[model samples]
Target: MKAFFSALSTLTVLPVPRRFHQCDEKSLAASVVYFPVVGLFVGVLLVGLLYFLKAIFPPLVLAAVLLFVLVMLTGALHLDGVADLADGLGAGGAPERMLAVMKESQVGAFGVIALVLVLLLKFSLFFEIIDKGRWLDFVLMTLLSRWAMALAAFLGKYPRVAGTGLAFIGKISLA
Candidate 1:
């Protein structure tokens, strides 16, 4: 469907038809329902990659590769959000000032630190999961994270008058 294709194109670097990339606002908002489906697809790809590479590389190297592939797959969209949020929170002043800081193109110290910490945490978790041979956890992790993103969008208010999240933020419903 258009909604699923829209969600897939928006969430991942994986190629979808160009027409799918240019969706109406309704289709964009409806795409929220398919976020978890996209996540499941991504998870399956990662699991398949892990199985293929498990013997070719050690756990540590494989973990890094998996993380790299995951980042590449999503085009580091969440990581950018994390860094921007860190920069905003780290500024620590009025809401307007924090928003200004976040809107700046350049990353600050807090952004770097946050990115490092997040990547490290993910790397460690991936290492542990691979070392323990818990491959299925990848599916659960990706699925739940995407579901959480949808839930947040459903419940969250869009602070700015207009921004990237306007299409879905506070616009999604359970129905």
Candidate 2:
């Protein structure tokens, strides 16, 4: 379906049906419905990579590689968000100031610290998961996280009137 392809293309770098490449209002709206499906595709790819390298590397290395691959595959979009949010939370005093901080492109000290901690946490958690041979958990967790993103986009308010999220948020089923 156009929706699925659009969703897959938008959510990840993975190739999808050619028709869905040019994203638009309708496609984005439809794509929200397929967010979890996109997550599944991403999860499967990560799982396959893990299995291929499982025997060839140690747990820490594998975890690092996995994290790196995830960042690459998703274009490090989440990291940017986390950094901005952390900076806003730490440095911004008033609500207006927080909004301004989040809007700025440059990352602050709080953002840097937060990213470091998050990366460390991700690496440790991933190391443990791979060590225990819980591949299924990895996939399920990936799926759940993506689903949560979709839910938030659908349910969360878009703070800016004109931004990338504006097209996808508040344009679909909000009930």
Candidate 3:
């Protein structure tokens, strides 16, 4: 239960009990298993919102609303990662320099372009999915993406000696 709440609080902007926000390293590692569950919860919300707004708004507007809801639900967590990675890679130098670039507070040109491209891609896809009435796809997409995060955590190595991601990276296992 603690692990589930930890995962939920970490992954989303949705409010959780304050106690759940303070977790031990073990609980944080255990929380990996609940990532997909959180995704499923978000997905259900998106689908429900889609159904409720489908009749009220045109397809394009409905898609934009659904995309906005999804971004808000997760608090744009993944998007930050996307922008950071883009900034790092775009710097295009030694590994150390790339890491330095990524750690900077200000976003660079690559970050802006990457964010724009990602959001545009998501909006376009949402428009198509809504037009096709494929609501369930949204659910499956969220679920699988979070599951993939768990898998990556289990398989990935933490680059820095200490950082936020260190709590999960290399700590999760298939068990």
Clashes per model (N, Cα, C within 3 A): 0, 0, 0
Worst 10 residues of 2 by lDDT: 13-22
For model 1, residues 1-175, the per-residue Cα lDDT tens digits are 8789899988998789876655677878999989999999999999999999988999999999999999999999989989999999999999999998998999999999999999999999999999999999999999899989899989999889988889989988877
- For 36-95, candidate 2 gives per-residue lDDT tens digits of 887888888889999999889999899999999988888787888899999999975888
How does each model score on lDDT?
Answer: 0.92, 0.84, 0.90
Q: For candidate 3, which ten residues in a row score worst on lDDT?
A: 18-27
Report the C-alpha lDDT of model 3 over 68-124, residue by residue, as the tens digit: 888888899989889999999999999999999999989999999999999999999
Candidate with best lDDT: 1
Where model 3 places Cα greater than 4 Å from the true spot, the runs are none
Q: For model 1, what is the C-alpha lDDT against the true structure?
A: 0.92
Against the hidden true structure, what lDDT does model 3 obtain? 0.90
TM-score of each: 0.97, 0.92, 0.96
